[model samples]
Target chain A: MLYIKIADLKIRIENKYNYVRALCKDYIIDECEDYDISVSVSDKEIDDEISVAEVAVSRGYAEGVCVYRNICYQLPVKFNSYLLHSALIEYEGKGYAFAAKSGTGKSTHIAIWQRVFGDKVRIINGDKPIVRYLDGEFIAYGTPWCGKEGFAVNDSVPLRALCFIERSPTNSIERIPASDAVLRVFQQILTPRDAATLDALFPLLDKTLMQVPCYLLKCNMDDEAATVAYNGMNNDN
Target chain B: MKIKSGFVVREVAGQTIVVALGEATKIFNGMIRLNETGRIIWDMLSVGSEKADIVRRITEEYDIDEKTVQADVDAFINTLQGANILE
Candidate 1:
């Protein structure tokens, strides 16, 4: 039995199998005398290719949301662990959002900022972070989808900046205008709806874009590049 | 189908917002913005001019080192068409 804890989620898988499928009420869950939090796949979903298993685990007030693909991940992560979906790292903090796609090195950039800011920049969560307009202020928190890095922390902080990164051949940065950055910001946001919330989300996105200052950060993969980007943001304040 | 007019460009939050570029007034689902050159081509088209004359005016006003202003016109119109910014 392997159990991994991601953000506020505790994920455990039992019984070695080739594939992982979503769990439903009809699926069979059992208790092992040797292993606790053991979940087994019912014979039905194992054969169905399209089926998905969603396990609900809770930690403190934070709820666990998980989607599993293979049985290889039955073992738990060493650090605040979360499973990975794709080659991506997304986290959230307070009202401001900092999003970068896979190659953009989202974690590396944030890590550099964290070192510079020290305690001022709290990494509320790592991996897949959730953002919402709570109490009239936007809040970003960590989700369980954190990757193998296992740096998921249970914390929340006020967002101050939004950054978009690109792999550049040169070691220079460009400050983009809000209008030019808004299109990119809208494209990076992760939101879902059931026909009722999409319209609302766009406006929320628009309002958020209008308020935040976003930058186009072009840099190489080096410590100096991170310092340059962080200091540029710090100087504006 | 409407005849193309002139477009007015403005900057909002660092983005160049293009509206009513010349009188054509296309109800575009997606908006379009012209850089330095797009504005120049748009100016000649606004006065109910022909394509050939517009190209002549563009070649004279801009230092663009390219052959066939005709190709540029075709490409620009195609982009506008694809963006639904033209009738």
Candidate 2:
């Protein structure tokens, strides 16, 4: 059993492999007697993950994935937390999430922001981040299951903006209505498998969308793209 | 025809999203975003409303003509049928 804290929730994970522990080493704590959640995966669950994985994954990797999947599945119903598939960056003390389909250059775009803004940017989580609505505001937390780049921190920042990125020849961005943002945002979240969780998620999802400003960004791989995105999202109303 | 079981609808930020759960997930792994008219039609279908009844309800709600409403409802129903959402 590995005890870890993420998104302000202490979790106990029972795993069969050391790889799960190694992957989650950053978030691991010495011990927790009363964890908020406990997750354990069956052999069938691990095998199911292996079968559906895009590339060939080891049993250990599959186990780790299954554990995270279980965590994501329970977050919304058990807690007001949800997983978002995006590259999260903290800039000027606020978190900005860049979400897109796989291979959509979300990482590349955030890298441009890093170069353009220099030390002003920090990558919170390169791939998946746990977002929790706490104290009337959404906060993005770094998790161990970050993407291939392996960039993540066991820290969090208040979420300020959510951007849906698209590849384009010229750089452009616009603030989109929540109604327009819902479908796009849906594409970047883990849909709960059961009806009860799905039902419980709608109001939280709506509240998050209503609280956060969402943008549709079309840009090329240019430093100017980062500037445009920053200015568009950070504009003083 | 009626909407299949295990299909849930929820309104988020003024947009209606339909998602599949449980056994329905095997057939529809994605969500369907519905506009106002689509939501009306979907609600009617959920109650097992007939085609003429749906058309009448839509016509009573909107300022559109009967022929336009009929065509719109048919197109929406056909979309639902194509997605295997209605049974």
Per-residue lDDT value at A203 in model 2: 86
| Tens-place lDDT digits, model 1, residues A1-237 | 344432223445553432222221222234334332345554444434323323332221011122333321331222211122211222233333446666577667667656654555555444555444445654444543455465544544444566677777665656667667756754454321111223344445555556556667787766666667666655676
Expressed as tens digits, the lDDT of each residue in A184-220 for candidate 2 is 9899889878977887788888998999999999999
DockQ scores for all predicted structures: 0.12, 0.81
Best by DockQ: 2
What lDDT tens digits, residue by residue, belong to model 1 across residues B18-39? 5442233434322455666666
Provide chain B's TM-score, model 2. 0.94
Q: By lDDT, who's the top model here?
A: 2
RMSD per prediction, one decimal?
13.0, 1.5
Clashes of each: 18, 0
In candidate 1, how many Å is residue A172 off?
3.2
Deviating ranges (above 4 Å) for candidate 2: none
- By TM-score, the best candidate is 2
* Error of model 2, residue A72, in angstroms: 0.9
